[model samples]
Target: MENPSYWAVVPASVRYDKKLRANAKLLYAEITALCNKQGYCSASNEYFAGLYDLSKKTIGELISQLARCGYVRLDIVRDERQVVVERRIWCAIESPFLPADPPPKNQGTSPENSGDPPPKNREYIKENKTSINNTPLPPTGAGIFAAYAGEHAGLLEALQGFEEMRKAKRKPMTDRARGMLLRRLQDLAPNDPAMQVRILDQSTFKCWLTVFPLDTDKPAAPNPQNDRRQVTNGWID
Candidate 1:
């Protein structure tokens, strides 16, 4: 279900509008440049406008739209001039397994072997009554909207990963996220008395740690007087 190919997920700007196409390209380029460099966590649309020789309003609108679509994000910091916005441009790393199935093969089990249409398929076709019937619906608050889930399932992992890289303050697999997940599962589970949250042996906490910093307040380990000697001697509890 996970797809890493750049083409797999439609870019927000692409799905958005022709009006944004040009600015989106320019904005993303600047974002990449800023992230590559050090000492710049927050930036203003003015700075980008000046860089691209465009109006600040255009830059502001583009950045805001990108942030909303998850193509890029903003980080706010208190400053005298204006609130700085750090961009998180969404980039896809290609997966080797993108083309999963083999190419269509000419075989005997073709139009002839297709004896009759499936009953379930026919029933589904009959139920296609409304414009909203078959189409994927947006996620609802009553539950993790099925529409939201289906649309996002492929990128649930990617989104989680990006969140971790961009904002480690909120961990993906931390106790907090896990606790929320467990509570949701409990609410959704059938009313069976024995049902419970089961932690399987094969499951490890490492996967969820993709986006978390263990303890930001904690300092690095102190260097000992016998640092080199300690390596030869195993650590003592």
Candidate 2:
């Protein structure tokens, strides 16, 4: 069996506007592959420059062009390292290009009537369960991104969600609350290096993230406060 593809949805569909368009195959593939990996994900021009083998000036121009077209996002911040962390996510897909018709989630039938034992291979059912309780698969980074395209792309989308929960949902979440949501998201979904760029460019969590991490008193996970911090303070600036 083939390993998860590190590339696909190639020849980035660069949209200058709702109507205008263009394509770049190899460059697109390289960027996609890098995004798929995980390291190159950042909004910082410097980071992107190093990853794509381009100069800072060139990286800046590319970012400007992509942003104008909505194919990339740039979040900026100055942390202790003083390095700007860029969380790029895929606008590479025309930045809302695809119709919002996401594939529907699976709705398993109830087992109360069927009474048959649950399949051993299914995730929701325990190995010794008598029947499926209609439990759904837990929300996972891979699952979230899978709603869009490939595993890598789903990973990218998951980054966006991570940004939302990690940064966007904070109280008074102004454009100054970038947190560790994206980094945690990256940690959870390390399927692609190209994913780093996409996440950094759009919803970067690891590039130059400033995470406060949650305290012990809070819920087990999904710290809204930290997320708010990241989102308000340039989580996706």
> For residues 19-73, could you state the per-residue lDDT of candidate 2 as single tens digits?
3323233333334343321112233344445655667566555555655765544
Tens-digit lDDT string for candidate 1 (6-107): 112334444555555677655654443333111122344545677678886677678766666555544333222111112223322111211112223455
Candidate 2, overall lDDT? 0.37
Top-scoring candidate (TM-score): 2
Candidate 1 wrongly placed segments (more than 4 Å): 1-19, 37-41, 79-237
Alpha-carbon RMSD to native, per candidate? 23.1, 20.6
Please state the error at residue 94 of candidate 2 in Å.
6.9
> What's the TM for model 2?
0.28
- Model 2: per-residue Cα lDDT at residue 168: 50
